[model samples]
Target: QRGECCSIDHSAKLAIPIMVAKSDGAINQLCQPGKKRRRAITRGQDEESQKASSSRRVTHSSVRSDGGEESFKWILSKRQFTDDATKQVIDGRHCIWSRRRQRIGEFDEFWTKSGKSWEDLTTVKDPETVISNFIAQQISVHATNANSNACRTAVGMLFRIQGFHEERINGFALKQIMKKTSCNYKEEEKGRTNLQVRNPSEAHTGKS
Candidate 1:
């Protein structure tokens, strides 16, 4: 037990609190809304109207400085929704999209809310490509220097949490490819770091 004693390291435990893990968009990252976006809790508002709406979702609107401006900026549902009114269907005892995200088949659609309009992420035939491209673009500017694998996995998890899954969106394929990419990139970065440490003179001259 050299330099080791039972001090009850909480990190070593199998389970950790959501806040402790800083998962699902961190504790406060989601608080900041985009210029035209507002995060409103679905209370008091026509929460019942959602069930009757063809969209089958709550809408968040944009506001102006001088007055109140409204537009369907985003779908504020605990579940996922598509522009396709047909997507709003009841599956057995639950909304097709609920606590469990399901497969929307090969032609699933994801409506990404940007500023004024919704970006249909599923315009392409393949959802996996869309997921990979989006993650690749995001990791380059992420707060943490995340690799594609982590970024892709995080986005995929978010979609799943939003009641979307399988071919309905990117599935295991993107994760597997990015996982291998992350491993290879980590190995390369480690080799470069070790080379610099082993030969400081070579580090400056760009020689290994």
Candidate 2:
């Protein structure tokens, strides 16, 4: 038995505790035999190797601020929001129209506060309904119907100028909603006008 070991030697190896240094700089004593200790060491080495490989792979693409790899979804979201052509168009509008710039700012603030991504328009279920509800919600916040209509128009223009297709913003549904809103505004105005005209006549008759 050239390299053979007796039962006593094997028992001695099993009785000893092996100290293993964790990746976090902590020492963990493993009460394992030779075979178990070897397997544990191999597993730890494999994990380190995988992590190093991941780091190397990330160097070929954009890195996040936190030193992590940029995910495809994150990259796509950034591109959609910061596209060069879209930025130029928006900048031009801002320079030419102060009111437009303000309205666009409001829309941007609303969108950012909602915590939604542009991708959600296409990816979410019943996007048309979702978009309609969002538009309605925005319009409801204004004190006057005219201001509400202006808010709706601003949101639509912003979506269009950002290169969103008709389908993306549910154009047909939006048109119908706008038509309804306009009719409602006219009816309210007419009622107020009639009341103003009638009030003076009644006052004159009472005086007579």
Candidate 3:
């Protein structure tokens, strides 16, 4: 036993400072190298931090999913202002009217391809529910995220000026979608700026 190595008690806390003194030979004998000790402490800290971060991420994701579903439902519940009296309200505004016509053509074409008529929207003044969903879906999926907010805003204005109920176009539910679009636009622009900074030539050439 006199020549044997001392047994290490791995479970002991090592946070206390080692004191070199006449009374502390046992502490000095059990001490590990500073780098290894620091690394073990850091590893434990990192694991704990990662677990907390993962929990936060899950909660955030759940909240986001629920909010998105509610917003989508609200947008889907909206009805288009297709009354005969209100139909021509935006006709004098050439650009808005043209956009509306374009949207209608696109919506009808989409349904026609699926063996459905645009007139199938006759239920519940439902001209809006499908069209609103279609516009949001198209813009969100097809339009560049950088222009997401602008595209939604432009189409949303068409609903507003055409004399739709405020909640039909500018309600809190619709605003949620717009808020998401604006956030995406900002994120996209930020990423683009970062990419350009990292590789100006590649960005200019549109290579990545």
User: Scored by CA lDDT, what does every candidate get?
Assistant: 0.43, 0.54, 0.53
- Minimal lDDT window, size 10, model 1: 61-70
lDDT rank, highest first?
2, 3, 1
Looking at model 2, residue 80 earns an lDDT score of 73
lDDT of 3 at 97: 45
Question: Is candidate 1 or 2 superior in TM-score?
Answer: 2
Which portions of model 1 miss their true places by more than 4 Å?
A: 1-73, 78-127, 136-147, 166-170, 204-207
In Å, residue 21's CA in model 2 sits off its true spot by: 99
Better candidate number, 1 or 3, judged by lDDT: 3
Clashes of 2: 0
- Please, what is the TM-score per model? 0.34, 0.43, 0.42
Q: Write the per-residue lDDT of candidate 3 for residues 84-198, one digit (tens) a residue.
A: 4343543445565433444344444444566764234333243345445655776756666534444345445434543466565555655666667668778888988988999
Q: Note the residue pairs that clash in candidate 3.
A: 80-128
